[model samples]
Target: MALRSNPTLRQRRLGAELRRMREQAGLGGSQLARALGINPAHVTQMESGKTGISVERLRTIAALCMCVNEPLIEALAEIITDRDKGGWWEEYRGRLAQHFLEMAEIEYGAHGLSTYTMAFIPGLLQTTAYASAVFARGFPRLPPHEVDLRTAFRMKRQHVVRSGKTPYSAYIHEAALRMQFSGPKVQAEQLGSLIEDSERPSISIRVVLFNVDTLPVNHENFTYLEGPIPELDTAQMDSGLDSMLYDAPAHTAQFRSLLKRIDSAALSEEESREFIQSIKKDMERNYG
Candidate 1:
């Protein structure tokens, strides 16, 4: 089979998981290749996601690595056999960075999502006007057409949360609510949208208030996307112009821990709504 010159995030994830398992098992590429009766270079390519592995090969690898987690094994199997191709995000292809497409798939496939942001409402919960205002402030200043495309893309991404099937929990800082990102009207509308979304049974919105005491300096924007199994979980943080997904077990655990700590400092769902409503009223009073 021809080696893939470039692998999508999902494909790369499969390779990464295999590499992790092999490391945990204390086996190197040469050893694995010898045992699997495949060329060592092929093994390298497969582990790096440059080559596709058959379902049989994937299971063989897991068995060799002695991965005892049935759920994780099944999840890996499903990932390899994922034939849905992709949707929506594929359309934007060259128009946006590949990271956006990867993120869309991540958001769409996430069984649930836990997000924490210090300066903005979670994108999945942003209103169209709010999204436009945020996008408009993009660095380098995108053209009008680019901004519109991005807004439309973001709106479609919101469907994942609005679908009401996948649960979403957002821990937004009070500072984010107060930011006049797109001006007071846009900010007010955005806050109102958060309150409205909070009503959905699958959605939980909390505010990390200003008086929550000093938090750890590590608190930054991140979204933990739940995979079918905990081992498949991913932590996403934005980098320059693109997003990065961390699938390592340690990284996943660290992000989950941070989320717990952040959640601990956040207001309860009811309190968050009240907090947001007060902010909205204040915006009307001050910005109007």
Candidate 2:
């Protein structure tokens, strides 16, 4: 099989997990290659996600590693067998950045989602008009047509949350509510949309008030995507034009702790709704 020149995030993650299992089992690359009757370079390629692994090979590797964690093995199997081909994001492959497609793939497969935003509304909750306005602010100034295309892609991405099958929790800082990225009208409409979305059974919206005793120092915008098992969970962080996904156990655990702190400081669902309404009314009263 031809080696993959550009493996997706999921593929790379599977390779990392396999390497971890081997390390835990106290085996070297050459030893594993010898046991599997393959060249040592093949092991290197598999561990780096440059080559694919069959279910049989994966199971054999698990046995060689003496890994008895059934749940984790199943999770790895799922990644190996995933045939989504980037899911709905495939259509935008050449049109949008590869990062967007990878992010969508992970989002679609998440069992649950938790997000915290300090400067803007969560992408899944932003209305079309609001999304357009947000996109218009892109650096280097995108042409009008490009902005429309990007906004449309973002709106479509929201379907994962709108499907109402995946549980989602969005924690937005109070300051984000007041930022008129577009204008008063768009901002008010976006807040109103958020109010309606909060009513959805599968969606939870919380507001982190400015008056909280202490806020986390790490305010980077991030979304924690829960995998089928805790071991596969991922934390996606976005900064400017870069998007980073961290699935290492330690990193994911730290992100989980950060989310817990944000949740504790945020208002309850009912209170968040009222708070949003108040902000919307303020926007209208001041700029109507």
Model 1 misplaced stretches (Cα beyond 4 Å): none
lDDT of prediction 2:
0.90
Runs of candidate 2 exceeding 4 Å displacement: 84-86
Q: Scored by Cα lDDT, where does model 1 land?
A: 0.86
Residue 169 lDDT (model 2): 99
For model 1, residues 193-223, the per-residue Cα lDDT tens digits are: 8889999999999999889876773746889
**Candidate 1's error at 169, in angstroms?**
0.3
The C-alpha RMSD in Å for every predicted model, in order, reads 1.4, 1.2
Tell me the deviation in Å of residue 224 in model 1.
0.6
Q: Model 2, range 1-288, lDDT digits (tens) per residue?
A: 899998887888899999999999999999999999999999999999999999889999999999999999989998888833557788887898889888888898899999998889999899999889888987889999988998898898899999897899999998899988888989999999999999999999999998986876475589999999999999999978789889889999999999888888899999999999999998888777
TM-score of each: 0.95, 0.97
* Worst 10-residue lDDT window, candidate 2: 83-92
After best superposition, candidate 2 residue 27: deviation in angstroms?
1.8
Clashing pairs in 1: none
